[model samples]
Target chain A: MTALSALIRRDIRIALRVGGGALIGVLFFLTVTVLMPFAVGPDLALLTRLGPAILWLGALLASLLTLDRLFMADHEDGSLDLIVMSRTPLELACAAKALAHWLAAGLPLIVATPVLGLLLNLDGTATLAVALTLLAGTPALTFTGMIGAALAVTLHRGGLLLAVLVLPLSIPVLIFGVAASQAAITGPLSFGTPFSILCALSLVSFVVGPFAAAASLRHGLD
Target chain B: MSLIDLANPTRFLALTARVLPWLAGATAILLLIGLYQSAMAPDDYQQGATVKIMFIHVPNAWLSMFVWGIMSVASLGTLVWRHPLADVAAKTAAPIGAAFTFLALVTGSLWGRPMWGTYWEWDARLTSVLILFLMYLGLIALWRAVEDPSRAARAAAVLTLVGAINIPIIKFSVDWWNTLHQPASVIRMGGPTLDNAFLIPLLVMAIAFSLLFITLHLAAMRNEILRRRVRSLQMMQANQKAA
Candidate 1:
């Protein structure tokens, strides 16, 4: 198999075998969504209004949970070294890892967002927007996330540090993600504006983030 | 010969020491002038004496970013050319950057209270600057957290370069969004809109702050090099004793 396919498959198998990381992330999202409505009371209108932001925030926090694991395990067991030694370029390897991460953590949260969105009293448009934005923007979370994971690979306790380091950088994602979702519910903004910006951000991340991660991994290896 | 020769730490140290006094003097002189001008500058017609806060606030904010840019370039040097001094330069700049960031935040809040009727607002420029401060703190903390100095330097260098992305976002957030913060007055498409009196003092403060940053960075780099030497000497002595 090609390196890309092989890497992707390996990650999928690993993700399935472990099972808990993605589950925990989605469960965290659900828990936050579930608990927030209780705190805000039965004001379904308020809930609906906040639905997109709540969903986006949940997704942000969820993705943050899985970030430390992205590189730490491979780094610890020396698998990272082997991967670095592989003929495939580090950027490709980074993409594979980020892609797997999105599939594993981001995709699950996205799939489960509708159920959570409904709990928040979202209408069909908001629900669809929340799901679609998460679908498009989660890749960005994973992509830019690679840079954070790569930087923190050598640290002993990187979980909290990774969140601190990555969260601020992810603000643009949060801004556009929530804006896109909210725009979907509100008046005249077609999906094209925020959606296109989100996609552009994702594309920029997909291209630049991998190369930066590659550089970081090389630095870590040294 | 001069270029290649300075690669020697000893020569670099000697040259820096020789230059330090002059840089320090210039910084001191500029700061004196900046403070005097800023203190005497007339109050804004709209803002009253509170406008004076801009002198310190703007300079500190500019240096906060200026120091980060310096760190980013130094980091690139460290990562790309493996310049031994570059890591020292980057590491040394982090805390100074953090200090400038803190000063900017505090002064900005102070300025905001008198002008905006509140101490804090989630204005784009403020929010981004606050984030920049956090990034500086994180980088400095990361540097101190790692046990091995070399490894820590590399980690912090990577983090600095990555965090450079935030600078533009902070600068442009006001322009891109409907931020509460006022748009560019000093740096618009046409020209600076401020009166000459305020503009001159602001520029002087900026130059003064840049000099201050340079002086501090040079001092910090010299101290870091000395610290590293001391650490190596201590390690060698321990090894000899063990032998």
Candidate 2:
């Protein structure tokens, strides 16, 4: 437990302090959300209707933006080899790193939802629904994205490959996250259905991602 | 010979060389007969001549899924048994799978343009297929990105298994989502209600496509084996020179 906690703490500190850390992801999320209004034009009604989708897209992209460095920094500094060789199982270590990534990178995107929601002309209730869905969904993105990050870690240039690998896997999360928000905002359908599926996706990825990432990481070891 | 015996690359190569010509010959014959049958089949009362596209479209779609199934099994061979040819099988199938997927998408769009009045729709079937195509590309990209062959194989095997799990989810979710494309007609409880005219030709084309895939896969595996040999030889020469 201490080892896991310590690993998490170390990852979070690096994410907070290095390369603009969580700030970069949040800023990128902000830029993506803010640009949607301008691109879609000044129609407030359109923006409001599109708000949940824009926010989800932003959050997805933001998580992906920060995910590339999940193992890259450790791999660069030779810590990944040590971590792989450690007494703590590599799967647990991977899960801890992903959890730390979610805290530093994913949490802020959800927090910024309300403020960014206003720019998209969303109401308080609607923004809250979007935020709730994002909160449920981003962990799926982070954990799944970890597999891609680990697979790509050995390559000299793997950033773009990581995106290609991760993006399609996240489509279900995007679909359900947006669906739940849409259901809440305007509904003939119930929000619970899609929300439940979103949670299930996160839970499944939580179990699967660490093992897969660990396997890839071990295979990738030089 | 035993499966393990065939795992030897030289044995595999010899076996494929013996089999390739027959496979290629069968594929050509089947394709010719299938196309002739399709062209001769009476036009659909609703779809008219455009129904011909189904012959190509449906088979391509089936092949797209079928190749992934092959890869998934090979991935198991890699992870579980550490079969010598398993990674070669998985790696060689990816590009062929991607090609079939691309054909499916293009032909699906063509069929849809005439039937649904649009080249594309965010329909469940279409979207799921698009995602499958993307996954194939990602697998190929990963294969290219990694420098070490053994490492790439293991990494890709893990990924393939992940994708196998996702395939059913993708299918189910697409079904749950609103879609314009018709639900399963062939594989349902009733079992393929398609007319004999269309069914016979469809089956013929499907067989042809499968055979084509086998022939191509065998050839690709052989090439991969040769490429590895060349790589090792070049590395050996470099080491000798350095010494």
Candidate 3:
């Protein structure tokens, strides 16, 4: 437990320090959300309807942009080898790293959503709903994106390949996140239904990501 | 020979070398019969001749999923069993599978333009299949990007297994969502809704396509084995010169 906590602490510290790129995800999210209004034109009614989707899309890409940092830096510095060789299970270590990644990277996107949501003309409740769904859904993105990070960790020039490999797998999360927020905004169906599924996706990813990442790391890093 | 005997790449290559011609012959024969049946089959009262497109479209769609099924099994072989040819099998099957998926998409679009009065719809079935196509391309790209063959195979094996999640979703996408594409009429709870005129030809076409895939996959595997041999042999020659 202590070892896992230590690993998580180290990762969080690295991500928070100068040039950590943790804040870059939020900036990218901001840029993407800000750009959408220009592309779609400044029609407030249309923006309100499109707000949840825009926020979700920004969050998804933001998380993806940072996901490679989960393992690439560790692998490059040889810290990943030590972690892999340590007494602690690689799966747990992977989970810890992903958890740290979410804390540093994913959480900020959720925090930024409301501010970005305003640019799209979303009201308080709608912004809260988008933020809430992002809270549930972004972890799923981080965890699953961990698998891609691990798979690409050992390869040369793997950044673009990471996106190609991971994006298709995240389609379900995207669908559910957007759907849940849409339900919260304008709903015949209750928001609870899609929200529950979004939570389920996160839960499922938490289990699967660690194991798959560990497996790929074990196989690919050699 | 038992499955174990074929685990040796040399024996597998020799066996496929002999079997490939016969497999190709059988594919050719079955394909002829299927095309004839599809041609003779009556058109839908509503769709008219465009219903014949179903004869090609359905089978390609089925193989698009079926090829992935084969890759998933081969992926298990690569990851779990570590069989010698399993990596080759999975690697070789990807392009053929991607081609079938491409054919399925193109043909579906072609049929849609005439029947649905548009080239595309963001219906669940169509979108899911498109995702599957993108995944196939991604797998191919990953395989190409990775430098080491063994490492590439393992990374790809992990991906193939993960990507299998989309297969069931594609199969049931119509039923799950009120999709523009029709739900499963041929494979459903109450049995096939298709009549004999359509059913027989569809089945024959599906079987032929499956055979075509097998023949292509085996031939591709054989080629990959030979390609690796050449690569290693060239390395050996270079080492000899250095020595």
Model 1, span A1-222: residue lDDT tens: 398888888876776552336556776676677556445543546777888998898899888878778888888888899999999998999899889888887899988987676557676778898899988898888888888888888555588888888899899999999888888898467777998999889888899889988998897675
In model 3, which regions exceed 4 Å deviation? A1-222, B169-191
| Best-to-worst DockQ order | 2, 3, 1
Candidate 2: tens digits of C-alpha lDDT, residues B1-243 = 999889899999898899999999999999999999989988988767877888898889999999999999999999999999999999999999999998987777677666544354444565567678868877876787566788899999999999999999978866664333344222111138888878899899999999999999999999999999998998988889553
CA lDDT, every prediction?
A: 0.79, 0.85, 0.82
Q: Where is model 3 chain B poorest over a 10-residue stretch in terms of lDDT?
A: B182-191
The candidate scoring highest on TM-score is: 2
What is the fraction of true interface contacts found in candidate 1? 0.00
Q: Could you give the fnat of all candidates in order?
A: 0.00, 0.00, 0.00
What is the DockQ of the complex in model 3?
0.03
- Segments in model 2 whose C-alpha atoms lie over 4 Å from true places: A1-222, B179-191
DockQ of 1: 0.02
Q: List the residue pairs that clash in candidate 3.
A: none
